[model samples]
Target: MDDGSGIAPPHIEGYEILEELGQGGMAEVYLAEQKGFGRTVALKVVRLSKYTQVDQKELCLRFEREAKIVGKFHHPNIVTVYDVGTMGNFLYMSMELLKGGELTTKIKSGRVSALEACNIVRSMCEALSAVHAKKLIHRDIKPHNILFRDDATPVLTDFGIARSVMNSGDATGLEDIPDLTEVSMIIGSKRYMSPEQSIAAPLDYRSDIFSLGVVFQEMLTGERPVNFHDPASVSNPSNNTVAWPQEALIFKPLVTKMVEMNKENRYQSIDDVIEAMDTLDNKFVNESAPLRISRIYLFIPLLFLISVAIWILSPFTTNYELTALDPNNRLIDKSSLSIYLVEGLEKIRSFKSLPVGEHKIALKVSGYRTKVIAIDFPLERNTTINLTPVSSPSVEEFYTFQDLLEKGPANSASAKEFTERYGGSVLSDLVDIWSGENAVLLNELSVAAKLNDPSAQLALSELYDRGWYVPKNSDLAQNLSKAAAEQGYAFAQFQYALILMSQMKYTKDEEEFIRLLEQAAEQDFFLAELLLGMIYANREYRSYDPEQAHRYLRRAANKGDRVALYELAQMIEEENPEEAKIYRERAIRLGFKVNQDF
Candidate 1:
């Protein structure tokens, strides 16, 4: 059925293919010799024979998308994208050749020094900062994706599943796949997938941080924390086991949080990860001063005098005025907070005396998240620390979670993903109500809505519309819907647009209402698409286009909306009676009852 020998072409775009390096699912890597400079390069190519004509075009578009993304990045630690084009039948890309090979090889040989590993991780943080600043997520970040040069500098590569956060581009040819549901499926190296990514959850920069944690863990222990790479194992938090030697104890906490089951619980950004790294190692720094020999001697005498003075005056003088801050920067009461002198030290809320030097302190509050912060005495600087509420998720996090639920991962398989990630939260009861797992109390639902949960927002909005929970207020419903919509929740957008459309007699912004409806439709909201198509069938709100209406109705029908199918049948009845009859029959099968009355 297959030939054993490789079909290595002689040359591509004047670059001679010297030898086969290896093969992957989508493409093959080759050691190539460039014609002009005679420089060696790694050329990745997708052979034409491996795919059909239609598939070749689709795969090439995907390959080109990867090229377009990586082309924008220029960093010493990032693989350099040379030229991207097609030669004969193969879509290929030339990248800077690395002679040292993959990071996986070095990791397998032996454990790297902790300092070396931290430095490598710092480089990754810097690279991720660049990527995130560009509003992109490197969905595939693993030891295998990291390559090394002669100098042992790590270079990040393979942008096959990287997604742009801007959401401002044409499809990555993924829609052209025969089974479109596969698009929502996990698309990365399983061993290094973030928990959010494991469930097909929408990702941000934090996802890359999680993946980097897996790689960093392996770098120190010579194996992954969770070795069996599968959708289930990767998603399960209990499977993660830190096998750290005594030397790596200092880094255990940071690594453990990096691979947190919840994105909100993880370090919020690349800067946060860098901060944790510097916290784990005093040697990692961004603050320093030049000390000459003369200054060193002068400073020693000055320190002796200051220490003598501090010894005598320290009893009466204040060492530092420490103030705890909530995540919002509001001054938290000292009574509710417990401040520890150092890591693993006893907790003390109020301190009478402290040393006149750098100190590390951990802040733990009853209902707030805990963190260790490095502080300097006599430092009254307004440095901020993030605090996550123990009882309820914040407005931003609540809305982000809603965005994840609405569009993050929605396939049937994703639905069966371990629920404990979201189920263990304080709002677990509220979530259970939404999933029909359990009922939530009315007061609890109201509290969740007030705390910014999107489902609670929708429920409260509906109640407001019918005078159920609190009061009947259409205006309040409109506001709640708009708030959720702005957070990129498709359901809220659709509801907000509908509420406004019905209240057009009381409201005047027809254009805004149409725009809101279209935004929801763009997200492939079936109901929104159907309503938009119906609205566009007439010039009731704005200039109407029959063609546009047909296009949207078609999209809704593709998603198996019976109302859209029935409407489409009506629209084509005069032009194509036979097709209309078939559409009508299908709509009826889907329980669409035809009615003459509006």
Candidate 2:
């Protein structure tokens, strides 16, 4: 592209080059005014003069392939290709002229609100879905590749460096073809490349999903999700996981999953991405990046009627964070996610509106458990219902209400689902402990307990430990808690460790108690992390290790355990006052009222 005088080419096969837009990796984009058609078009030209004759032919093949690939797309979100031709030493292609420019321009100025960002991300997903449907991958998915129209409708552009495609998966005939990508040389922008792409590994549509995650994060936070500015380390990410801002806590889980380092962990397809986006509250997007002052002014001119119109036009629906948790309190990823409306449909793929009333909904996740609950929603905003996994049972897989009492772990997904259904009314009647000594209460607890239901066992253990309902049997409390912990219940494991570690009775061995603490800490139970941190940091404790203690403290602090953060600050106070102050401030923000004397 000529920067001065615009004299690179007066006319390229009759299309006059009015001005050079910019130079890309392999091409120079020019704003070309079509002489015959009497319209302006974005003309991209790859100069073949720099390469040898053989390489030039290969480049032409790639260029022609790009043109053919893009020509198949007729979506509203994609930039339409108009013409393709060779002009002297350059292979050129003409595309839709987007006067509003690239989306990167707006992102450079400031972040857009979450709602608008979602709208842009949604548009990108639709466009990418079209490209992916043809079994082609758009290897590059940076913000600059997305353009906007006069009305600010995002249009996905630049499908030049896409993955190579043969005429019909031709392998033997293409044996002589040179590899477009080499392990030594990384393709695509470093900042936007997925974990697989960064390693120069074979990619699928999921790579683009990761790249789009980066773009959307920038749209919300005004900066790329890179912890460090080192390119060498970035190409092979040491720990490339992005940490969402505190302001973005609502959508953090979704964003985190999108940018997952493992390709298998990412959202499978655009359909999945859209589904997750649907459940997310739009208010986060609205707050993440706000509409510009100019955009606000444009709406202001329409007056109060327009505002009312928007409010009414918007769907009267609530959002939910339908999350799945294993018994260990770990998040289950990419489960067989589905939602169904009672009495209407088996699978509700899209939700236009979920009315504010008692709605019977069934939720299922593969390999874990199926749960159905009647939620009085919009009030239960951002609902995170924890479902237990189906674990090993000695007697039978499907246990009945009576069978559940004798089973090993009443903590089965089915048992938990049953409890969720009846626990409300059953517990409602037992509001006061004095009036709760009923046959049904004891019977249900036994069923749940036999099913190895951790919550049920925990409740029973509390009763026995404090002599509330049962004969305050310390032995019974310890045994019941150990049963729950053995089944990988995080909270139960933590409490069980406490009972065993107590010098008052010491029913369990010391070694077993330490192992229980480790189990719960590994699951990131906050108190477990805090307890382990304190124990390991103290020399008087049985096992003391500063390195492991710091690790646990940092983990607890990261999880917003204020005491853990304060402890970390105290430990590092003499070593680094500034760093300690930073930790103290963070702890303070998390509602850990620090000493004013500090």
> Which lDDT tens digits does candidate 2 get at residues 322-351?
676666777767434556554342334333
Top candidate on TM-score is 2
Local lDDT at 297 for model 2: 54
Backbone clash count, each prediction separately: 0, 14
TM-score of each: 0.45, 0.46
lDDT by candidate, in order shown: 0.66, 0.66
Query: What's the true lDDT of residue 496 in model 2?
Result: 87
lDDT, model 2: 0.66
Residue-level lDDT tens digits of model 1 in 408-454 = 33332333332344443333333333344232345444544433345
Per-model RMSD to reference: 20.5, 26.2
